[model samples]
Target: MEWMSWTVPTAAFFIVIGLILLGMTTWELRSPSVLRKGLLPIATTRGDRLFIGLLGSAYLHLLVIGATDWSIWVASALSLVWLLAVMRWG
Candidate 1:
């Protein structure tokens, strides 16, 4: 139908996000200690910060991007919750 224009731009936007995530992942791997601190400065170290950031970022992107598609949004939200639970329990 007339989905070409919308699809192209949406795909491009998602691709850019993917690239940014890739860069962040690479940086995180190289310097995980930098991410240990929680955003609010809890007693966390660089590793914890990185872990939380990764989970939070995924949570945010999934919530916003998948808003129109509730199923995906829920999946993303659950993942975030799961990550937080794991961190707290372990």
Candidate 2:
């Protein structure tokens, strides 16, 4: 445990991921998902859209960091917006 070197952001990130997974599980149990087409141009289930959104957000952050001098907060905001859009209408 001492060797793990867990920082606040790292711990928070993992905690958020865990919470998202738990929430998705609960939502699934409450109401089953069906595949449907959206702005993504392909049918996808809720889980699929979630995966895509997360992946895309990662890339968006990386792209912003690597390609510009803007603050990470901007990238984070953009990623959050993208994630919400995908989850809502992807």
Candidate 3:
């Protein structure tokens, strides 16, 4: 059987995600989240905000890539900003 090939960037991406999940799990175990309202209409916990941020970032990246002639770097930067904003105030 052939093994899957992994590139450095791809591996790094997964590694970062794993680290975030680990950190979140540890934080949750130490102190559970409480629902709070932010800029988003509904109250959300940390995990909910994280999920929304990640999903929004995906859509932002796709929209930027599909609807514009911007470089991937630009899309990535925009997605990062969106993710941060969502996590902070969504």
Please write out the lDDT profile of model 2 over residues 1-90, one tens digit for every residue: 368789998899889989999999999999999999999999999999999999999999999999999999999999989999999999
lDDT of 3: 0.92
Clashes of 3: 0
Report, for all candidates in order, the number of backbone clashes.
10, 0, 0
lDDT of 1 by residue, 1-90 (tens): 564456885788579768856875787698763323233546665446446656676776676666665575566577666655545442
lDDT of 2: 0.95
Clashing pairs in 2: none
RMSD of 3: 1.2
lDDT of each: 0.60, 0.95, 0.92
Higher-TM-score candidate of 1 and 2: 2
**Model 1 residue pairs with clashes:** 33-46, 35-46, 35-49, 35-50, 36-45, 36-46, 36-47, 36-48, 36-49, 37-45
| Candidate 2: stretches off by over 4 Å | none
When sorted by TM-score, best at the front, the candidate numbers are: 2, 3, 1
- What TM-score does candidate 1 get on C-alpha atoms? 0.34
Top-lDDT structure, candidate number? 2
Model 2 worst lDDT window (10 residues): 1-10
- TM-score of candidate 2 against the unseen true structure: 0.94
Ranking by lDDT: 2, 3, 1
Give one digit per residue, the lDDT tens place, for model 3 in 33-55: 99999999999998998889989
